[model samples]
Target: MLALNWHRPLMLLAVAMAILTLAAIGGMTIDDRTLTGLPIWTKAVKFALSVVIYSVTWAWLIAQFTRWHRIAWWAGTVAAAGLGLELTVIVIQIVRGTTSHFNFTTPLNSALWETMGLSIIVVWLATLVASLVLLRNPTSDPARNAAIRYGAGLSLVGAALGLLMVLPTQSQRDTGSAVRGAHTVGLPDGGPGLPILGWSTSGGDLRIPHFIGMHAAQLLPFVVIALELSARRIAATRPVAVRTALVKTAAAVYTAVLIVLTWQALRGQSLMHPDRLTLSAAGLVAAAATGAVIIIVRRRPPVDPATIQPTRTAPGAIR
Candidate 1:
C-alpha cells in the first residue's frame, strides 16, 4: 500500500469546501431564487464541490513528492488559499443575489470579479510550480508517473482555456452591456442550458472544454488506478510497460478530444448539435484511441510460465 502524506492546509480547505457544498445544497432547496435560469445557489454548490475535489487532489499529489517537498507544500498552500478566496467571493456574490463572474455592473462587482481573476491566476501558477516539482521527482511506478505528469500538464491547459471566456463578445461590445464576458458563444448567457451545469444548449458553451480539461488530473489518475486493479485479475495487463503505454495513449486521445471540443465550441456549435466536421474529428480521435488500445494489448509481453505458482494438492485422498 502506498503511504500518502497529505498537506495540512489543502486538506483543511477540502474540508471547508465539503461543508460549503452541503450548505449550498441546502440553500438550493429552500431559496427558490433563480439566476441565469438556474437556482442562485446552484453555482455555489458546483464550485464548492469542484474545490473539494481540487484541494484533495493537490494535497495527495503534493504528498507524493520525495524531493522539493517544501516547495510543493508551499505551492499547494498557495493554491488552497487562492481557491478559498475564489470560493469566498462566489459565496458572497450568491448571498448578494448576483453573478460572481464577469459582472462589472458596479465598482464592487467589478472588484470582486477582478479579485477572482487574479486569485485564479495565482492558483494556476502555484499548480504549475507543483507540477514541475512532481516531474523533477518522479515515483518508481511508471504508470503512476505518466498519469501524474500528463494529468497535471493537461490540467494547466484546461485552466488556461478559461481565459477565452474573459474576452468581450461582439454583442457585448455593440450593446455595451455591464457584463464584460460570457461562457457561451454566439448566444447570450441565461439562454436554454443543460440542467445542473447550466452549459448553453442553444449554442457553443466554452465551459464544456474547460470542465473537461480541468478534471484531466483526476480522470487520468483514476485510469491508472483502474488499470492497476485490472492487472490483478487480467494477466494481459500485468506488465508495467503495457500499463504506462496505455496511459500515455489515453492521455494523447484525451488531449485530442479536448482540442476538438474547444474548436467546436469556438466555432459556435452547440455540443448537442455537432456539425459533420466536428463529428468527423471526434470519430477520428475515438478510432485512433481504440486502435491504440488493441495494439497495446496485443504487444503486451507473454506471461512467464515460471512465474506461475502451482496449486497445492491434497495429501491423502487425491494421491
Candidate 2:
C-alpha cells in the first residue's frame, strides 16, 4: 500500500479550486436573458461555487483535525442548523411580502444576513476553526512556511470578506433604515447603469455587496493559488520545468483574463461613465496584484522539492 503524504491535501485543494473556477465560468454564462429562478447560468454558478467552496472548507477542517470524532459531529450539527435557519427566515420573508427574490428579496438578503442568514456565519466559523486545526503545524508554521500561512490567512480573509457582504453595514443606508420594509427600498427606475454588483436599479441598492462579492472572486482564488504555488516543489528535477510553467501561467493566463476584464471595464460607450476609471484601472490593479503574487509564490519556495515527494501513494495519484 502507498503511504499518505503532502500531495493528498494539496491535490484536494487544487481539485476544489479547479471546480470553483469552472463554477465561476458558469456564473459568467449567466446573462440578462430574464428567466426566473436565477438566470440558469447564475444558478449553475451558485450551485457549483457553493459545493466547491464548502468542499475546500470541509476538507480543510478535516485535514486540520488530528481527532475527528466529536468535531465532525459538531460540524455536522452546525451545518444543519445553518441550513434550517436560513431556509426558515427566507420562507418567513417570502410569506411576509418582504421581497420577490428578484434582487435579494429573501430574508437572507444583504450582508447583515450572514449574522442572521440561517446561521451561515456560525456554520462557516465552525468550518473555519476546523480547517485551521487541520493545517496547524507548530514546528513548521514560520514565515518560511508561506503555503500554510497563506492558505489559512487567505481563506480567512476571503471568508471574512464574504461574510462582510452577508452582514450589511450601516453605512449603506441610503433608503429608510433596514428596519423599514423591503417595499421601501428598490431599484431606481433609471437603473444607474449595469452595476458590478448590488441592486441600485431596484428600490434598494447593493453596491457594497456587489463590490465586495466581485472582489472576493479575484482575491481569494488568487490567494489560494498562491499558497498552492508556494507549496510546490522546486527541486533540480522540476526547477526548470516548474519555473517555466510559472512564468507562462502568470504571464499568459492572467494576462488574458485581465485583458478581458479590462476590456469589459473600458468598453463603455463613453469614458465618462462613473465607474469606468475605477473599473478599468482598479480591476487591472487587483488582477495584476493577484497575478504578481502567484508568480512570486511560484518562484519563491523554502521547501525542498525532494521533501514534497509522496512517501505513500494517494488515491488520486497524478499518474
Q: How many residue pairs clash in each candidate?
A: 0, 27
Give all candidates' CA lDDT scores.
0.92, 0.41
Mark the 10 consecutive residues where model 2 has the least summed lDDT. 180-189
Residue-by-residue lDDT tens digits, candidate 2, 179-294: 32221122222244333222233233333322333333234345335534655653422443343344334334433443343333223222223355546765666676577546
RMSD of 2: 12.9
Model 1 superposed RMSD (Cα): 5.4
At residue 159, candidate 1 shows an lDDT of 94
Score residue 279 of candidate 1 by CA lDDT. 90
Positional deviation of residue 265's Cα in model 1 after best superposition, in angstroms? 0.8
Q: Residue 66 of model 1: what lDDT?
A: 82
Clashing pairs in 1: none
Candidate 1's residue-wise lDDT over 1-319, tens digit each?
A: 1322488888888889999999999999999999999999999899889888888898987887789999999999999999999999999999999999999999999999999999999999999999999888888899999998999999999999999999999999999989999999999899999999998888999999999999999999999999999999998688998999999999999999999999999998899999899999999999999999999999957678999999888877665
What's the lDDT for candidate 2?
A: 0.41
Kindly report which residue stretches of model 2 are placed more than 4 angstroms away from their true locations once superposed.
1-52, 55-64, 67-73, 91-97, 100-115, 137-152, 162-237, 240-319
